[model samples]
Target: MTRTTAADVRRDITARYRARTAKSRARHAEALRYLPGGETRGATRISPYPTYMTAGEGAWLRDVDGNRYLDLLNNYTSLVHGHAPPGIVEQAADQLLRGTALGTVAPPQVSLARQIVERVPGIDMLRFTNSGTEATMMMMRAARAYSGRDIIVKIDGGYHGSHDFVEISVGAEAEAGLEPKARLESRGVPSSVLQSALVAPFNDLERMAALLEAHHERVAGIIVEPMPNTGGMIPPAPGYLAGLRELTDRYGVLLLFDEIVTLRLAPGGFQQIAGVLPDLTALGKIIGGGFPVGAFGGRREIMAQFDPAQHDQALFHSGTFNGNSITMVAGEEALRRLDAAAIARINGLGERLAAGINALFAALGIRAQCLGYGSLQQIQWTDAPVVNLGDARRAAQDTGDLHALLQAELLNRGVYSSNRGMFSVTTPLQESELDLALAALKGALQTLLPYMREVAPRLLR
Candidate 1:
């Protein structure tokens, strides 16, 4: 019998994907003419072409090609209750008839803000925004205004949405040392960003204290994700968040939590679980019920700076759709549905999924690990534990082809996930659905055996 060549496996998966997604291919080809890279967002782009999604139901998506997939990506963890739940749809529809954007401080907007302030321990008064980008951007502004400082420290590989100042050191790897340079993530971000932002590795408390000791005078706050979703879902070291709180209080600098993604880890966000509160919190994703929304809130003293009564010193914050009725009502419904019981169920499924993947890799003699916290996990190809962005990057160094193959195979088997190996569990996901996912993962890995053996032999145990 002839061995399965890498070329053979590649052609097989490509042919299968193309055959199953003819309409998707056609739509993508048309999109390429008008949209850059044939898509609106960079994250959803796949190698052959992006899938054209038509509709979504509980934990499932129907593509233009009529294929049904178990959606593990959950629109990058935004669709917490899964796409278009009955209550969210109805609430949004009622508001839609009333008004989408009333150009005033609508009741629904206030109700949503109240819901957030009540839930999050750190948030005393909060304001809404159009996106997580806006929330984080405004959070930084509030921190700076309250503290009267210009410099902000951010964790390497911690993403607080895409704006100019926070663009520093995003997913940036160190060239020669443990710390990555404060490199800007996108172009058009001003060069002055390098001075205002200082980057440090995640899960490194000693390094964080040292940074504060050196630059605490100019630093307004130190912002980080409790568990950086993009940085391989590595949990914070036991006292990492507590240590940060101590450091910030000692240095007279504010502490900020970017719970844009990690908020769903618990009912009140990761801060509640860690028993640490931030002076400011930036939120997005699940809070909006799959709509475009964002919010930031913190201590009364700091947030009071934004009050109109403060006169000249007050930070005038306003947006046309800051508290739009549609998103506000929809978001309220979303949060209401995601109670503690629902969170626990999904988190159990997520842990099971993570464990199943790790067990499968070990059984198959593959050197890989799936590390994560409640309801979230990420696959890193290297055997080493991923504690920070540098560790994650080094683990990913030689597994591009392997990852691409596995993702394609998983798609072919009716599972959809992020190309970056991040998987999120939605409230609608069931134990039975998890069984199908594990089967698909096993099938994908088995299919990729030959390719891994040939191209990434070091990955074999």
Candidate 2:
């Protein structure tokens, strides 16, 4: 009997992936000439090249190689209604016929803005942008303008976006201290950008309060994700969001919630559920109806920074495609369709998926946990409580290889998900689809256990 090492399992998986995705490989090779690493987005890049998708619909994607997959990635949780819902497509097409970019305030844009202002608890007024990165960037700028402060506090491992300021300390190596240093995520991000931002741990209210207290005077705002999707789908501890609200109020520093991912958690977003409101909220993803969009808004006084009436003191905010007709109509349709019932259905599936995976890991004697809220979930490979980014980082480091192997195996089995172990349940996902995904995950774990035993004996319970 041959004892298969971790490397052997990975080799087999890579071979299978390559054989099934030859067209994807060729396309990637051609793409590499124009795009760096053969992709525009960094997260979609997989080792041995990535699968090239030709089309997607109703929670399924068809690859260029003609292989079909259950799309759990859902465009990084942007596709709440799954790929190109009939309504969204029709709405977008209608808008395209009317005008894609009218270069004026379209009626659909105003209508959608009104809906958002009425729904989201934190937004009184909002300005749209091209992406979530722009939303967060503008939020920070508005915060600085309102507070007349230069420094901003951000959560370690919380992925706001790729913009210069928020690009600090996201999934950086954990330091051996209470106060974490702000490490630059990208090379071109200036050191001065890092200097302007203070990094704090997610879910650590006491430590965050202390750090904020020390830097209260210079701090403009504290930006955070209500439920951090990137840092292993770590949810805030009970009363954590409330504590942050209190701290921000006490210190006179603005609170900014990056609800780009967590907005799908509730009609009014995580803030509505948690009963904690931010001074400014950054939104994107699902709100765009699967199109590219972003928005930031807050209290009337704070959001006045973008008011054209006060030109002298106003923080200049404008984009070529901001509130374009296509995105605005599409977003309106998406939000109109995403009711409480739909949210509940998808979230329920997510809970079931998480529970099923956790039960499987426990039964198989694997030291791992599935953690998330609402429709989002991730498999953290360590038993340690994910109280902060440091804990999550340590846990990931301990089982990085095994986690990668699990992702590859799941992909080979027709389930597509993020390599970082994150997956979302789309509105179109059915109970049967969820069952199949869980079954695939269970099979992946069972098949990979021998390799786990070879590489990580201590992981066995």
Candidate 3:
């Protein structure tokens, strides 16, 4: 493939996507009346309206319109074993026959907790929640209660969940009034909450140290995604996580690792890979085996804040659907199946896919790159090294034309990935699936090259 400019690629891809979207617009128009943005999640919405998936199995998903495509997105990397895996389905169905939510103790809950405790080294005791958002919220509450402090620190571009406290500064642009150190991105997130949340650039140990020093006594915790998933899967730099641990300890602040997405990176999640354990760990996604579940656990001394036995405990955490039998059964089975060997195998597939994509970009002379860690990968249309959210924001702006074209062309070619080019490899995906994806990617790139040539001549040069 010949080198092409970004603008020409954008124009060509947009033309094709507009035509395809025209046919789907009627359905989307009807959906918008009931569902905001014609989608269930904020991130899932994209131009041309997102394709509504009907069913999924193994490494493939079929849309409502009968379009079948390889399931590279993997339900945002939650379905590590792939959709409707036999073990997960069977366990869930068995538990469903018994009951859904008893609002009481169930055997499966204990079973799943044990599995998690056994797998994750840092977790001593665990509490269940309905979603990662809820788990992270509970983590913050626990951190505050344990430290008797109000403020929390988060990495820039890190996404813990949709909760107001942690959502600040995520996906915020520099022009959006985001300060280099900290800024609030959402309204109704009380000024108190905003004031309590501090942001530090990822991979910047010195800046983080400065923030910790400034906030010292008032900082309850330092919460971060061990690997930033929201801003295109940027891995933590060497010693970066260890540095955070040291700083948090120095300031007497709790260190919380939000591994909701990164849990799939290893059997013990990024903490194991980074070799730095946190005071608390937030978990979700693959742990639930495609079911809704969230959990937070750490040192028993700190986690006792949630114990009902503690009369004067300052923290309270409870949810009706938490520890629901169906979710517990599914999660238990999922974790049971997700051994170290399985994790390594899935990661191997991701490495292969990433290598192929990077090679394609080099061969085609496109200023694109793949970034991720273990089963998760994101395509960035910039040659710049992305270390922090600021870097991601810059990359997004500089390569907007190329990103628009790449997404449209990939969609048209029947390869579904997140709008930001996030893709995950499931256990069920074989080399053949990888080959198909690579071929589809090649075709899409070839089709958009003419447009790229017209748009950004300097990029191709």
Taking all chains together, each candidate's TM-score versus the true structure is: 0.98, 0.97, 0.93
In candidate 2, list every pair of residues with a backbone clash: none
Q: At residue 154, what lDDT does model 2 achieve?
A: 93
lDDT tens readout by residue for model 3, 1-461: 85655555565677776665554667788898998888788777767566667788888887766677887888788888888998789989987888899979888899999988888878999999999999999988888888889888887777888888886878644443344655666777766677788887778888778877877889999898887888668888999999989988887889999999998888888999989989999998887878888999999989987776864744677788989998888888888888888889989999899999999989999887889887998886677787776777766764445654566677777777877788898888899889999999999877766765665444453
Please estimate how well model 3 matches the true structure, expressed as its whole-model Cα lDDT: 0.81
lDDT of 1 by residue, 38-105 (tens): 88787887868877889999999999989999999999989989988988999999888887998888
Candidate 2 per-residue lDDT, tens place, 52-158, comes to: 99999999999999989998999999999999899899999987888788898889889989999999989999999999999999999999988889999999888
The parts of candidate 2 lying over 4 Å away from their true place are: 172-177
Better of 1 and 3 by lDDT: 1
What local lDDT score does residue 241 receive in model 1, on the 0 to 100 scale? 96
The worst-scoring run of ten residues by lDDT in candidate 1 lies at 172-181
Which ten contiguous residues of candidate 2 have the minimum total lDDT? Answer: 171-180
RMSD of 3: 2.7
Off by over 4 Å in 1: 174-177
User: What TM-score does structure 1 among the candidates reach?
Assistant: 0.98
